[model samples]
Target: MSNLSGKTAIAGIGATEFSKDSGRSELQLAAESILAALTDAGLTPADVDGLVTYTMEKNPEVEVARALGMGDIKYFGRVNFGGGAPGAVVLQAAMAVATGVADVVVCYRAFNERSGRRFGAGVQDRGTEPSAENAGYAWYTPHGLVTPAQWAAMAGRRYMHDSGATTEALGAVAVAARRHAATNPKAWFYERPITLEDHAESRWIAEPLRLLDCCQESDGAQALVIVSAERARDLPQKPAIIKAAAQGISGSTAMMTAYYGDDIGHLTEMTLVADQLWADAQLTPADIPTAIIYDHFTPYVLMQLESFGFCGRGEAKDFVRDGNVELGGRLPINTHGGQLGEAYIHGMNGVAEGVRQIRGTAVNQVADVQNTVVTGGAGVPTSGLILGADR
Candidate 1:
């Protein structure tokens, strides 16, 4: 077992209301969520000794610490890769707590993605100002593969061709996500469920990719509290144990385009992460009673299931079609709705949902959910976690 496993636990989770327009600054959202999480964990700002957040977050770590009145942060760090950083943030926090670097740590992500700056709109030059990331994008934008949807389209098309998966197969993912979202009161798409027909009828943003297949651009923030398992036992809410956490970046990876790889349809990076997660936790796909796979785009959900060994290669379509992803299914996924139906806070909300499931407090709670798998962004260098209920 990994040294971090079973050492730290998620004591609390908090989030701002999911919405298209938060009507508040991102900094305010971050501060509010952090405070809420601390309150839930039965800890004051003075108790926090570490902080972790995404590099994409506009709020500075010192600024959040200052806003919260946290005393002398002992550890602080940031993970990168857009939505891929959410679970990684929790991992960083868990490491800090488990290693005795900090007694209490907060992991947070907040942004006004839709209302302030849209990430889907292809940019001319994100890294033109002499950053290493700009140098990475230089290879693709010149070829007109700029937008996220367009970049993902290349691999998505290959998956369809190789596996003979139809648009309907992709539609199943969107339908399931929206169905769960429709039931979740906090979901932005609450009471607005979509059917497979709706998915098919939706206009295409990229060929074989419909509007319904895309995740929403949301404005919000989410925060999680990590502390020693012993400390979590005294918190207000039940703790979600950090069974395992891992981040993976495959060789020859690119921003959103890795077309030159040996297999365009495979998610080798996620596969690599999955291998470590199950090993670290001493669990398998069968051990996961539920999952919160990242669904920034629908196709990647299918690929993620396959990469995580939920089913055999090219069998995700059949697995999903057999109702394995719905409520009461073998591996109910995105039960808190997903990026598709829920507001997309760059997958941070997904992590919050995973904690809820482990706590047995999810609106669509699975019975006897002792273990759950939560994944970060797909189609990029991503991360994942295996969360278990605190015994």
Candidate 2:
């Protein structure tokens, strides 16, 4: 456990409308989301003295600040590992606020990921200039492992082998997410729930992963405003206290080709995140009544449940076997839909959902919710949050 835990809170969250195409520049979207977050916190851009964002996002922090006409930024940072970086953005902001490096920090990610560059479409061409980073991806890229589905299929197939989970189990995850999404107007799949059969029939992106198994390529941005827990109480909204914020990278971690580990089906990075979160927050899986696990891929959702000790290893298939993840189930997930149903903003939307859940303002609010979990991208160097309602 660390002193940083429970010291700060996410005071507000804001986002641009999710869509297939924003028809706007990424920078403009970044500015819009920041302004929205500031307003949501009942503050102006001048109140933000720190900024954190994804390294992969095209928008730069200084540029975004200038666009928003912000005050002098005392702290600025960029986190890596694609979607895995979202939680880290909040972690950075929380750390800054806790240490007084900055009084207020806004963490954001914005992009035209769908219309501009679809990550689902896979690697087209990496420029000649490369480094140690590309070497890991290079090992499998030449062997038909260029796409995320392809990489996930290798991992999912191994999971089924070790856990006896069938492709149908993966479909069940997609079904639960879509069912939640059906009622969420912000979800891309809102009012369009599917069945196990629909998942079976959907075209395959990879052998083990169907089109429904993968998440949507969305265009949008999400931002969160963070301040000291003391400061949050005086703000205009209820505070979602940051019980814990942690990031991890297992020894066996790779970009997406994390195939060197003893168990290919497991998300060890998430496990690492879980250990720190639970200890730092002084809580357990049983304490969390709601969750917003990343659903970029359905199988990873199952692995996350296991990694977080919600279920034993190789038991997630059974854990999610029924309608356990749907509304009114033991663990209702992605109430705003998910990356699969909601427009994917690289997991930032998931964190915002966590804030909403703690604030009791979620569109699909869970009953008597107290503690909530928000996980980042599962396969890469990841992060997570344990958010609780202020006592």
Candidate 3:
């Protein structure tokens, strides 16, 4: 096992309410969530010596620290990519604490995605640039593959075509997430459950990807407190020990539009991440009874299951159909509703749910959840985490 495994733990998790309009600035959301997390950890701003967030976050570490009245900070870092950053931010914090670079580090992501900057609305013309990030999009953006759903549709369609899977397979993911959300009072879709027929009738944003197949573009913030395992054991809340943390990039990695890779039907990046997570944690799919699978798009959820070795390639459709991914099943995924039924805080909320399951305090708590898998966004240079109960 890696030296980082079991060395750091998530002492607390917090989030702002999920909604279409937060009616607040991203900075305020970040500050609120951070304070809430510190309080949950039975800590104070004075105890924090580090901060981590996504590179896309507008609030700088020093600025947020200033807002929170936090004292001297020894370490601060940022991870790139959109939804793929959730686990990565925690990874950064865990590394900092494990390596003695910081004592207590908080990972946060706050955004006004729905009201301020909707990601599903597709990309805008910022003119041309000589940058590599822009160049990667040039190959497909002009072809009208701008929105995340559209980019993901290309892969989803291919997976269906190759695996003989129908749109019903995708709807299965949506239905399960909503079912879990129906009972989760904190979820936006609370008491709002849908059937496979409802998913089938939903308007198609992109072919093979119905509106329900897409995750919500929500306005919210989520945060987590990371500290040494020994320190966390002394805290009031049950610590979600960091069993493993990993990030990976595959051939010609390019956000969601990695169609040029060896196989457009597979999430190779996530496969790489999954391989490392199990190895680093010295665990396997059998050990994890539940997971917080990234559901930015439903099709990717199926792909992630296969990539993580939960099932054979092209067999995820069958696996999900067998009632294995829902409550009382073999692997209850996204028990807190996921990005589809819950709020989309760039997968940070999903990570929080994993911690809750470890603490046995989740609204849709799974039985015997010794460990839970938390994955970042797929179809990109993604990240994943394995959170287990304190040993």
Candidate 4:
């Protein structure tokens, strides 16, 4: 079993209201969420000895620590891969706590993606920056695979052709998310649910990809507190144990455009992550009571279900259509409305929602939610986590 499993727990989670525009600096959002999380945990800033966040996050560790009036930090780090780093942040913090390197570690992500730099618009001019990373984009941007939606469209279409999954199958995922979002008071799309028919009628951002199938860009921040399970029990809230957390990158991966693979339709990186997480947690997909599969795009949600062994190859469409992913189904998914219905804070908010399920405080709570499998972005090197109720 993984040494880190069951050693650390999420003591608190906090986020500002999800919105299209926050009208505040990303740094301010990060600071406010961090403070809110600390307050929720009944722990002061002085208790924080470590910090973790996404490399894509605008606010640095020192800045957040200083702003929160936290004392000297003993450990601080950041994970990369765009929206795929949220769960990995928890993993890093859990390791630190388990190793006695820190007592309280905060994982956070904050951005003004909608109001500031819109990632969906795709790359423009980075001014001749010479880097191996930028070079990868050069190969596709020229052919108009500029936006994330476009890059996802290629793989999505190939999956549909290979698996015989229809656009209606993809619409099921959107309908489920919006259904949950309609009941969530904090969701930007609260009280607004979508139907599968609506998903079909929505205009295609990319062929075979409807506007509702793509996640909305939003401005917000989310933060979580990681501490030892022993300390967490003494906190105000019930702890969501970190059963397992992992990040994976398959060979020859090139961001979301790893088309050189034998199968452009497969998400090998997420499969690799799934292998590690199940092994580390000593559990299987059958053990999970609910899921928060990263829904940056609906097609990816299907691919993730397959990669994680929730269903047989090319059977995710049938699996979801059977109502297994809906609330009160076999596996209630994205109980917080997901990035599609909820604001997309680069999957940080998904992690927070996972904690809520474990705490039994979810707006759409699943009965006896003993385990929740939460995934980060797919179509690239990604990360995942298995959070369980304290044993």
Candidate 5:
């Protein structure tokens, strides 16, 4: 639809070993991942002239640039809404490269979520500073609705009530992700598989959300290198073409809470993203052979399928019922294991998986993957990407 579509490509993807504890500073993790990506792309740190990352990212761009000895960075920016920003980082890097803002750009995310401050543990302090942003969180912090799981559970419960979906259906996503992860050495749950019975027996974080339903608290970093498609063709590895990158916020959207909207059971924001991505790429679900939905919670994955038109509303339960998302299924999804099976790198790992699928190098690689859809965080203002192999 525009120059941004198919003009840029993801040339490289890199990540540190995903673990519950990195035992290092977040800055070190960021630098390690960036360097690894540059190496993977057969480039040096000097090749980088632009950088994009998440607003919640602890490592500042300047520090990263200084650490890598990069010169005269032409562009540096950050995306918002936590995990919602991962796909948007690619959008930013692609726009910068396509528009002559920079020649080589890298988008990255790094964190020590498990060893440091755990978002799942809830807000630790309410300082006396009465700020507007803090006040926004204040609205939901009380009444025992603090952490992300609690916030997301509201809509998850409503979806079950409306769609008549069972907890077993939700567990199916975890099962599929784990099944894929079992073969992926990079996955934290590597060689470990779970059954529906295991998911059923797990402890509940919230009423409708089980321990297995939630993504893991992980310490890791992931990075992607983007350059013009013309330049990417000459690089070391096959390029994952940036067919489309879109960010969207539904009218009544809020971070992890959009209960006021008409369809509490559906992800209106992902629907908005799907419309723009389809228009930008001139493709639809029928063209995509694989997908990597953000799995902060299993219920959101189902909603995203409906939002992306992979299935009808309230039909995701049926869609995932019978190995539909596994290796030989119609649409093999989360083949690198999603956040449930792989480490949760705030959705960046999912993007890397999408790129790997395009390059035919994923550990659980699908066959003849012409297009793969990678989604950012749901239950908030979000983003999505359609990465195609260079044609």
Candidate 6:
């Protein structure tokens, strides 16, 4: 629906190995991934004129440019909302390229989340800083709503209550992701596939969320090179055209603890993203052969399916239970293993997998993936993308 559609494409993708410890700085990881992407695109550092990353990323754009000896950057930007930012970075880069603001833009994210700082540790000791985001934490922190799992558990419980989904439904998502991951040599959980019984036996991180339900805390970086569709056609790799990109924030809510909303079980922000993606791309759920649904938590995966209209509201449990989300299924999702089975690079890895699917080079490659829908984290301000084969 906008001029940006089909104007730019992700020409190449690259990433550092997913691990719990990188034994390197986040800046090194960023630089390595960017260089790898440039090489994959048959380009060089001097070709880069724009950079985009998450606001939470410690590596600054200037530092990364310096590390790679890149040219003078004409455009540089940062996106917010933690896990919600993976797609937003690409959106910024695509806009910059489509508008003639930059010729080649690289979007990247790198962190030492597992070894350096674990987000699962929750709020430890905070400085006496006052901000709007911190202010929201005050309301729930006193009530022991600290970690991500705790917040997700509340929503998972409500979803099960309203939809009649048992804990087994959540386990199904984990099981499917692990099955995909078991074969993906790049996945952290490769050869570690789990079953429904394994999920049931895993220790509970929260009431409804088990250890398997949570995504791994990984340390790595992923980068994608974006350029005008015309330029991308000349590149070495098949370009994953950006058919649509959108970000959304619906109800007044905090990061993951938006229990004050009318319904804690639904993700309205993701619904808004879905509506925009379908409308902007002039496509429907049936048009997408596969998807890389963000799996920060298992329940949110189900919520995303319903929000994206892949299934009716509260029908995701039955849909996933019926084996609709596995390889060779009706709508196989997260063929790269997902955050649950693959290492969680904060959903950036999922986007790369979408590109791989479009290129028909994925490990668990689907049959006819003309288009792949990739979504960011739910339960927060989120984003989504529709990547299609160049027609």
For candidate 2, what is the total of clashing residue pairs? 0
Q: How many residue pairs clash in each candidate?
A: 0, 0, 0, 0, 0, 0
Off by over 4 Å in 5: 124-128
The C-alpha stretches of model 3 lying farther than 4 A from their native spots are: none
Question: What is the TM-score of each predicted model, taking all chains together?
Answer: 0.97, 0.98, 0.98, 0.98, 0.98, 0.98
lDDT of 6 by residue, 44-113 (tens): 9999999999888999988999999998899999999889988888899999999999999999999999
Which pairs of residues collide in candidate 6? none
Q: Give the worst 10-residue stretch by lDDT in candidate 4.
A: 123-132
Please identify model 2 stretches exceeding 4 Å from their true place: none
lDDT of 1 by residue, 1-391 (tens): 4678888899988899988888999999999999988988888889989999988889998889888788989999999888787778888999988889998999998988889888888776565777787887887788887888888888899988888888988998998898899999999999999888899999989887889888999898999999999899888889899999989899756668878898878998899889989999999998888899999888889899999999989988888885679897888899999999888988888888999998889999999889999998888888999999886
* Worst ten in a row by lDDT for model 1: 122-131
Could you give candidate 2's per-residue lDDT for residues 1-391 as a string of tens digits?
A: 6788889999989999999999999999999998999999999999999999888988888799889999899999889999898778889999999999999999999999998898987874754457776665677777878888788788888888899988888988899889988998988888999999999999988988899999999999999999999999999999999999999998798777789898888888989999999999999989988799898888899899999998899898888878888888888888889899988999999999999988888889998778999999988899999999998
Local distance difference test, candidate 4 = 0.90
- For model 3 the TM-score comes to 0.98
TM-score of 2: 0.98
User: Candidate 1: what lDDT?
Assistant: 0.88
- Quote the positional error of residue 109 for candidate 1 in Å: 0.4
Clashing residue pairs found in predicted model 5:
none
